[model samples]
Target: MKYVILIHSNPDPWGHPTSRYTAEGRALSEEQHEQGDRAFDALLEEISASGELVTGEALADPASSTVHTWTPEGHLATDGPYAETKEQLAGFFLIDCASRQRAEELAAQFAGPGSVVELRPAMWSGGDDQ
Candidate 1:
């Protein structure tokens, strides 16, 4: 009944919105910022009303990503993420759902104009929190 919706970006696209933020684009102008706050409020209200959002967040840029892979040898460190192509995981949502269909319906509403959210059931270990 719980799922993680991984948001992915299209790599081949030249003007991907996720790729739009640069050093100069970090902070928006006053009007732009006001609009952003308004949008955030509306989005939060939508999520709360839907009953599909448990907790979610917009992630920091992928450039800040740190990768650690382990093998028999030990651990391997890398810069950024491990996306095969340009597409990368931008963010995610942890949700409790009644059915897969309902989850998918919720995903469709959340994706917006040019994004995809992959939903997968989560596995939590059964043990006392240490």
Candidate 2:
């Protein structure tokens, strides 16, 4: 089975992976940062070695995102996400797992404090023809 894991968290707490703000933002202690990094690395290694990791990527800050809506007239573009929420999608992992339980386990491990991981099965895959 295939699953997409959506990673959500407050950007203020950790910023983007490449962000330079460590103190002005929701600053995590140095130790917390190191531990989180190690855990994430370990999880990725485990999944890759198990041949479950199809692909993964971390997203840019939500501030850079755009939302589009369709009106009776035409499409309209807007700034930011479609909804306002404390947690923004930070990243995602696409994995081929043996079962939902396995996928849930991976998602649980991927999610950290104040973060959420959502595992959803793809309704239609890229290669599938309707």
Candidate 3:
């Protein structure tokens, strides 16, 4: 089974959990940064050993992102992100596992602190051999 994990933030439990989901800063604390790096590093090692990490990447800073709209002439460029939301796209990973349970386990193990990871099967647009 293969899966794609969409990394997004979720509500923090204590303050304003409903309308106000506390946003984890794009910049992590020194300890958080170290912990994240170590966790991801271990994840990568595991994936590599299992031969399941097909492809993956950490997105560039949202501040650097370009929000563009299509125009008749060409692709129109704009500044900033694609949407205004409490949560934002952080990064993603694609992996193949033995089953949904396994995928969920991996996702659960790697999910960032105070974040939501949506795991789903990859869709195929064309039939095999297409």
lDDT of each: 0.64, 0.77, 0.68
As a TM-score, model 1 comes out at 0.65
Error of 3 at 18 (Å): 22
**Candidate 2: lDDT of 4?**
91
* Candidate ranking (TM-score, best to worst): 2, 3, 1
Per-residue lDDT of 1-130 in model 2, one digit per residue for the tens? 8889998777554466522232322356767767778887889999999999999998877878899889999999999876588678888889999988999889888766666788888567565331
Backbone clash total for model 1 is 0
Task: Evaluate residue 116 in candidate 3 and report its C-alpha lDDT on the 0 to 100 scale.
Answer: 74
RMSD, every candidate, angstroms: 6.9, 4.1, 6.9
- C-alpha RMSD between model 3 and the true structure: 6.9
lDDT of 1 by residue, 109-129 (tens): 555334566877777787333
Between candidates 1 and 3, name the one with more favorable TM-score.
Answer: 3
Error of 3 at 126 (Å): 3.9
Q: lDDT (0-100) at residue 34 of candidate 3?
A: 68
Question: Each model's TM-score?
Answer: 0.65, 0.81, 0.67
